[model samples]
Target: MDQQTIINSLPLHLRPFVKQQRYDDYTPRDQAVWRFVMKHLSRQLADSAHPIYKEGLERTGIALDHIPSIDEMNACLARLGWRAVVVDGFIPPAIFMEFQALKVLVIAVDMRSVDQIFYTPAPDILHESAGHAPFIVDIDYAEFLQRFGEIGMKAIASHADLEQYEAIRELSILKGCPQSSRQEIETAEEKLAKLCNTEQAPSEAALLTRLHWWTVEYGLVGDCEDYRIFGAGLLSSLGESQHCMDDTAVRKLPLTVDAVMSPYDITREQPQLFVTKSCKHLSQVLEEFAASMCFYRGGTESLRTAIAAQSVCSACYDSGVQVSGVFTEVLCDAVGNATYLRTTGPTQLAYRDREMLGHGVAHHADGFGSPIGHLKDFSRCLSEYTIDELKAHAIEIGQPTKLEYLSGITVEGTLQEVFRQDHRNLILSFSDCGVTDLHGRVLFAPEWGTYDLAVGSAICSVYGGVADKESLQLFKPTPRTSTLRVDVDPSLMACYSLVDRLRQQPAGLDADDGSIEDALLAALAQYPNEWLLRVEMLAVADSNLQQRLLEELRQLGTANKATEQLVAMALGDFPAPHEDRPASA
Candidate 1:
């Protein structure tokens, strides 16, 4: 399929989060940050990262010297059955997974600032494109990513999940913006920390996301004791990648379903990492977790899970009809089998992931409710009954119909319609129907409008979100906020622009003359702490200027260990930072 065709096929709800890359928005300094991180990361990762990392970079069209645009990535990714879209900051996790399930990668729209060249807490182009896209060259890993998305979208989430996601997202946004105050970042950090420590039980979605964090975000390949870097988190962060392999600081655990028990914090470096045996093994562990999710094992338990979540979800009946809405209550019998279930507001009925004719949310805007078990005399689910069989039960259009269930739920009305698909009756509509439970409690009043009964014996599967996502937009898309653009003084940008221009034209620098070095020194005198600019100046500076640049860098290096290491790294002395641990890492 063509790239646009594949991307357009993504669900309607996900499109709102997608934004234009606006390639021109990247400032000259932004370009410098991308080059600095990519050049250094590629060099160090050349030895420790997976072999696929190097080859994938070429195939994926991730440029080491420039911030790659969405169109550029799409051209290359389309060849591998993938496409790229730009998104601002953090999007909802569920929406992100949905995009992935369609084989579309969402590249963050912003680049990290020069100060955050080592690591940025927020989602950036560096983390999403350079960190992730390269690995898609491996077919096995690509499949795993899609499968992860498939399973992730269906996993049941808790009420706190969105709140927690928003907290972390806020923190990342605050940290990424260069103008953000210390107090703002600290407040966001406190809020996220509190949410992390909440006493509420973890939901299936939360646990499954934990597994995603371990394997896809920060995973290693090989044995627990020894491994190569593959996860995007480590692959993107210069400091984390260097320090992560350390045994004393970050414990390496063997990848398994149990990895879900270990939650991750986005604000801090992980104290531990999981190592899978291979790329294929990543999916194996994921499937193990998938097998345990409510979407796979549905019944009264899954219904209860949906009720606890208090969000939009889908429950598939054995008869192949699906009810999608916020589950409010479930009525069970003496032995604990669900007798009837109800959804509160705006529900939809779907079959095979498509909205049924005249059974969308508009038709059932108030809510939807139905009996859960087989009828008294019918050994088969009512949906399985043929037209002739229903005639035997005196259930024909415009005829009086009375249905009794084993759970004492009764429906009495004149049959209005029977919606069928693939030779199965998916829904039965009745006029002036009065539904009553065993205690004579009216489930549905006769005065109400047409009663649409979903046909099924019991819920066979339950999952997050509406079944017909393309037809039903259940959640509101978070408003897109543009990532922080560098709007600094023009003079400051002039220096960065100079360095950026120097990179594009290497021949501009002449060792025979010290003009370029003198120009850079004049620029540096204004911005005293622009260490990266100094490091960039090192490449083309003559011996006299190179010595001067080193001396200045050495003085700036004393300000902090990160600076010290960067200057040392530029000089190639002591391998700069700790490959095992950056200072205080």
Candidate 2:
């Protein structure tokens, strides 16, 4: 989204709302409150917020000295054909929408003392004007809000329950309870505590409320590369502002509608944040949502039905091959169609078969008798031993295979003594034992020579020397190997190859020493034969580089799992700020 264009297009009236003058209208007390709030919130913002939000404050011309007057704000907004109105208190949903249709921004003018920060039931001037007004000047943001208002009005006109509309809107506004008076704040907080204690509150409402508190109220922006703050709630608070940007406890994830809607607790500093690439992207998302609802009154399914369906891709892995490292998952679900795939777990691998061999264990062995061939040959094989079979084997051999003999082994026991010995010449062996030699080969050794026996006997005995020459020469028959082959999904192969290459490059290549495009190309090249066509398709889809590379990949039919991950890597997540909630007592 073009932020500069949005800024350029903001109506003259609304421009003032973004300026510091609106805050100047504040009374001495209001100014004191603003200063106090700013001081605290600013501190919090510095810790967890996006840099854009701070920029927004600078753009809005808000200063630490005063409370902005509604009239003065309205005057500034008037230039952009926007106006701010003082509300008696919480306005009805109908009025809220009506104000939006008319392009008049309504903010409840209330204030809280430092002592009263924990509880409030009425929309105070701090919560509304400070929490919401600046974004009103952002053209795309203003459009988003207007569209939201329109959709909300339509829903109301259609006789959709006012409660549901209120609930959803509350999810976007009212970070927590807003009080009309000190007494009211105290009473409302008591009620909330009772409700929480009783556990009778609707879980969905609680979830939505928490989501609003976190994202709309205190959400942060940026990743490791860069970040800024934009949420109104954060913009208005002093301490929260600093805490959000610097704290280590916070967990940040890329923004998604589901993630935004997810529940959170607002009483303390947030442990996580949902980040978007930019406010413009968020505005576009909201716009798309509004449009979607207009077209599909019942919901998203109708849209899905209208579009051609894409085939779903599934990742397959070998059973015994443990992937004990981090990997990425990408899922694509347009408004109407939804599908998900994950590439996470132990003993699992996901890759396009065409670009690389199917998921399997690598093997190493000694000469022709080595089981390395078996590992390389078998595709998608599971090493299984039924409890009964294991028991039988234990009875016959006096013990089942020790944990040391197993690949990806987990077991509990102790080996007392070495029973067998064969030392004469270098010996080769094979077993279904699931052990790997030094060459990344999966091998099975059958005969227990002194050398092998000592290693397998127990952890303590592993270093014992061979007793005799005859104890070292053990042999086993060469087992027939069945080669396993898996077809790689060309697109995935290319992506993985590209990522791997980029990871190997010197970190100083790009300005940040990181080049997403370069990394992508390298990952693709790593599996040249398998992903050539896929790479070509991706390049063609993204030929203009106008859309996000991941989005373009989706358009080119790349697996959602891979694309989602690549996008996440490009954009990092930051923790949102915490909303001030009423104390339970």
- Highest TM-score against the true fold, candidate: 1
Alpha-carbon TM-score of each model against the true structure: 0.93, 0.38
lDDT value for model 2:
0.39
Candidate with maximal lDDT: 1
Tens-place lDDT per residue, model 2, 363-470, is 111111111011222231113333354344341233444332222222212322222222211111223334443344333333422111111111100000111112
> What's the CA error at residue 262 for candidate 2, in Å?
0.9
lDDT per residue for candidate 1 within 1-585, as digits (tens), equals 443554476667777777766677777777777877888898889888999998998898888888887777888998999888877788877888888898889888888877777768788898999889999999999999999999998988776887888877777777888788999888888897888787878998899888889988999999977789999999999889989978899898899889989977775789999999997789889999999888999889899999999888899999999999999989999998888989998999999999998988898888999999899999898999899999998889899999999999999999999998888998899999999999999999989989988889988899998898878976565544345554667786777777667666757466555666667778878878878777777665666677777777888888767678776666763233334856674
lDDT of 1 at 46: 86
